[model samples]
Target: MDMKKDYDLLRERAELLKVLGHPVRLCIVRGLLNEGEKNVGDMQECLEIPQSTVSQHLAILKSAGIIDNSRQKTENYYHISSPLAKELIEVLFK
Candidate 1:
């Protein structure tokens, strides 16, 4: 691969990681990974966090493309977008 492409990919990955650096976002990611797909209410119940706070963190994760959402009826469900999240979380636990 070209060096330029590698550099660009690294930069993009760095930005994604930076966006996920917050504790709240990390928690949201972890919750999604563990629970498979979850709505804001599920995250709030599992994480014991306020709905607004969880939504805020989820917004960051969504903006960063680290997670994706789908609407089911009136609820939006969230899940990890990449396998990198699983790898990162495993490393964090090690």
Candidate 2:
């Protein structure tokens, strides 16, 4: 096997898992999977966390390509983007 290529991919997966290691991020991912698409306001309400905190966690998930958002007028609705995250969410939460 190509060690470098495998290591690179594993490194990326590890980083994504690392980003998900936080409790808030874990709940946010699980929430998106369970609740479907939502905006920062919806996440804030459901997670019972500050808007800024939710946004920060959302940013991390977005950067890791675990979730994505769509703009509808003034609101940005986010949803799970990575199939791996989706699968992990289902397996871990279910």
Candidate 3:
């Protein structure tokens, strides 16, 4: 592969890493990975964090395109948005 193309891909990966750098965001991602789709309340309960804090981290993850949300009744469900995120989280445990 071309070095330029490799560098570009690495840069993009770095951007992703930066987005996932926050402890709260990492915990949110890990929760989503383990539980599949979950609402903000569910994450808050599982992580033992404040609801607003959970929402803040979820928003960050959503903005980074690392997770997607769907509305079910009065609750919003979230799940991993990209296979790359799943892979990276998996690698973190290995």
In model 3, which range of ten residues has the least summed lDDT? 26-35
Cα lDDT tens digits, model 3, 7-73, are 9999989989998898888888888898789998888888898999889888888888899999999
CA lDDT of 11 in candidate 2?
A: 96
TM-score of 2: 0.93
Q: Write the residue-wise lDDT of candidate 1 on 1-94 in tens digits.
A: 7999999999988987798788888888877776689999988987898899889888888887789999999999998997787678657766
What C-alpha lDDT values do all the predictions have?
0.84, 0.91, 0.89
For residues 1-94, what per-residue lDDT tens digits would candidate 2 score against the true structure? 9999999999988997898899999998898888799999988998898999999999999999999999999999999999998998788877
Clashes of each: 0, 0, 0
Superposed by TM-score, candidate 3 places the C-alpha of residue 53 at a distance from the truth, in angstroms, of: 1.1
Judging by TM-score against the true structure, name the best candidate: 2
What is candidate 1's CA lDDT for residue 54?
89
What would the TM-scores of all predictions be? 0.82, 0.93, 0.89
* Local error of candidate 3 at residue 59 (angstroms): 0.9
